[model samples]
Target: MKKDKEKVLDEVWTEDRVREFLASEPKAGTDADFHALLKAYQSMRADDFELFIGMFLETNRNLNATDKAGRTVLSYAKEHRNSGEHVAALEAKGAL
Candidate 1:
């Protein structure tokens, strides 16, 4: 059991893994997908979050997706504490 836990922790998130995870998700360009990404972004560390975003873009996921209220990932990052790196990453991707 301990070894299983350790192995799980040792697992690295790959581009294929990211893509697989998104496969069952709502359409890539949908608001639901954007919201899902936002939730993941809020939970991840800056580096991992950046990688996720890169994978998202590589899969042709929406970069400038917005919520029903028109709130975007950038706007959420700006509102989040210690999210400067996240904001920068999103901005570098032309998120608005």
Candidate 2:
């Protein structure tokens, strides 16, 4: 079926904008619940992820937590090949 480009974009743009609007929710602090933590993790870019992990690890938290998808923060570092602070955070998190 031929699709109308404008119609598709209009439909998609609302959700996209909403997602973007809702993306950068600020956590109160280190006690982010598991769901919030997962969303925060999923929403992060590589550098942001590293920074967050560093924050957590600085307070002695482990970043190697498995999500509902059975993926860990280590999984993201491995997937992105990010061999920097993110990796360090994961290591600090006890993520092998």
Best by TM-score: 1
TM-score of each: 0.69, 0.38
Predicted candidate 2 versus true structure: per-residue lDDT over 2-47, tens digit per residue? 7666433223233233334223444454223233335545555445
Q: Cα lDDT of all candidates, in order?
A: 0.72, 0.49
- Whole-model lDDT, model 2: 0.49
Per-candidate count of clashing residue pairs (backbone under 3 Å): 0, 0
Residue-level lDDT for 95 in candidate 2:
65
Which is the leading candidate under lDDT? 1
Per-residue CA lDDT of candidate 1, range 46-68, in tens?
Answer: 67778778778877888777877
Off by over 4 Å in 1: 1-30
Worst 10 residues of 2 by lDDT: 9-18
